[model samples]
Target: MTLRLSSMRKGIRRLAAVDVGTNTVRMLVVSETEEGFRPVIRMRRITGMGKALRETGAIGAPEFAASLDALRDFRKELDRLGVVEYRACGTAALRESSNREEFLAEAARAGIPVGIITAREESRLTWEGISGGGGTGDGTLLMDIGGGSTELIAGPGKRDFVSLPIGVVLLSASFPLSEPPRSWELSNLGHFLAERIEAGTDLWKRRRFRRMVGTAGTFTTLAALERRMRIYRPERIDGVRMTLAKVRRWEKRLAGMTEAARLALPGMEKGRERYIVFGVCQAVAAMERFRIEDLTISDAGLLEGILRGLCGRKGRG
Candidate 1:
């Protein structure tokens, strides 16, 4: 075998990963280094694909166009950056759509290949991503709270993971709330999620985790909003410990506010405000159901996992 100069200078290579999740589509580009992988470009947009799916069995006309357009733009940016390899996949929204083929066709038209991943795959990749943040063992579960679904995975090596239809969007759809949800409305939402969180409930009953590492939007936003950090600082939020008490605190505070007020609050994103109360509820439910004393938040998720896989493959070959 001939030795290549590029092999010794592999740290200069870059790769990309894209996650077409229910509520948001995100992409990340990173470069490999002796120190580890470092990020080059990151983009995320909430196109409300899942919200559209809930209202209709498919991505609505406008939603469809917007999502594909965003993707095409990302592809151009990735190309501009000279990313050597990229992987892209879609989760719950694409999985549940009755007209998923339409979305797939659009992606193909845009020259972007988007794979529809199963619930199990979503959980596993989420686990893979968070685990890369370190601390896999010693009774820690990786939890991903999405707009369309929630995943709970315990024991990374054993792969004890399940993706439930329980999500902020799902819960919001199931239990419509008034601005400042009526006590009864909140009760119904609690009861609705209580039944579906059985996977976590069962796990925590038998085993108590020392801590949990949470990924995806809900955890990240909650952590930032709690501290009133208008500017996102991934370094400060990542691996930071959040107590159950804080979860409940935010839950109660948000429940008392109207959608407009919630949106006006610091760290609250415009489109995400209304559904976030439910997100907080799910977080509280998870802490209680999983018997977790605290949570460590990780911003890395499906996109990061795919980037690692693609980058690692290139480095090896």
Candidate 2:
């Protein structure tokens, strides 16, 4: 379905969504028309804000500087395109950083207000964006694996959401797997995640969900690789079902490959190759912990979620 802006608000306006993720800064600009909203531009820069903060417990000067530069560029683009409304939100990276207020201050100085969203809000919006108001019977299990945190929410729809703190960037930095992780390392990470899963007693054990759905780059990349797509394609990845057994197999294969070998594989995005192992491990861990046999990968996530929020607000007006 084509997502379009209502004719009532159409005047060649543009809405921008900036997602300040742990590993990358992403911006999506969409034009509103009578027909709907059309994507005009999308850009992402790998900043590794989560990695830096995970190690130091604060957003270091260098990483802060780099993030500012990226945001400045994004602000310039919005001005160039004459965007009407802009919303920027930061996730796990900013949430965990001790100096997040400083970074937000710098960002505000540059004309972009960076709001730190709670994991619960992230999960709810994600489900809303993907389901588009269609209720998931027995509820749905939603997973978003960002660089700094992986959010898992199980609910009937958007209203009853729960979030977890396990993320790929956090795990990668904490584990420090050079190539193949030793059995001890894997065991430790698994135990760590298991505890998190156990804490979600009610949600994890709910018999309501018939299936699991995942959003974010990690799942999208895995789906693309599984399908052997030469280039990233949202159409191919969205709503694609991935079985737990299949993901485990792929995770095992990646665990054995060096970073160089992974980079050489077709469909592996350049910067993403380095973190594939971490992503796979997290996915596998979630599956094993929850006993989720199958997951559907979706590319529509935070950006779409933001847009939907805007639309909902507009509708209320």
Candidate 3:
């Protein structure tokens, strides 16, 4: 039941959600009405919090500076648009950082409360956000791949979720692969990730979900490449099916390509080229271990989830 804009009444309240992720700072502003939530503004900037944390066990000065600048800009935008209520949440990077209090204080100065969300909260909120938007079945595996950690949720719907710490940025750094990684290297990485995923089999075996849905950059990029699209068309990629065999082939192709060659690939985002191989490898490993033959991609994730919840709350009020 997709709601249309015209159904919304006048004088609808506006809400904003800010996700300070390991690699990106994303903001979404939406209007709430009886019809549904309508997105007004959305933006993302790569801040690389995860990279700095891996090196120093803290959010480095450079990354902190970058995030502050981005947040300052986002503050101006939110004020300019007259957003009534807003919430900012930080994930793995901030949660694990040695100087999170300092960063939080900096964010407070900008009028944004940078709350460090626990892994449990991250999993629960993510499940709420995705499931609220619909399309989930009775038993489905929901996976969100971020820069610092990957979260896996399985249950009846959005109400039940479990999280994992395997993320693309962390995996890329931990598993260093030379351009065109050797077969042995690929095998080693795959085995290591598979073991981690296999640890979740107890829960997976209990529910026995038939479908897998993936959200975030990694799966979206793979969808674009698989379709050979020159531009990222969300309509085309979202809900697209990706098979384990196809992913394995793509991983091999990417693993064999030079950085220059990878940059030239269509639908490949410039900043993401370096880590795509690792992301693909992780996705493939999970799929193989879980016996998941195919996955569906979703552009909607935590941001959408937040918007939906905010709007629903306002509507009920």
- Model 1 over residues 55-120: C-alpha lDDT tens digits? 676777777777898799888876676777778898888888887898898897886789988878
Candidate 2 minimal-lDDT segment of 10 residues? 1-10
Residue-level lDDT of model 2, residues 1-317, one tens digit each, is: 01222332235778888998888888878876564567777777777787767678987777788788889989997887778787899998898899999999999998888999987777777777677655555545777778877777665344465555567767777778756567777778767777765675454465545567888878888887888877666767887898888888888887777778877777677778767777777777677766778888888888878876775555311
lDDT preference between candidates 1 and 2, better one: 1
Under the 3 Å rule for N, CA and C atoms, how many clashes does model 3 have? 1
**TM-score ranking from best candidate downward:** 1, 3, 2
Going through the candidates in the order shown, the clash numbers are 0, 8, 1
Task: State the lDDT of candidate 3 residue by residue for 191-287, as single tens digits.
Answer: 8878887785545555566767888888888888888778666568778887778888999899888767887888786667877887888788777
- How does candidate 2 fare on TM-score? 0.88
Count residue pairs with overlapping backbones in model 1. Answer: 0
For candidate 1, give the lDDT. Answer: 0.76
lDDT of 1 at 281: 85
Off by over 4 Å in 1: 1-11, 133-135, 157-159, 199-204, 315-317
Q: After superposition, how far is residue 260 of candidate 3 from its true place, in Å?
A: 3.1
Clashing pairs in 2: 3-37, 4-36, 4-37, 5-36, 5-37, 138-208, 150-166, 150-167
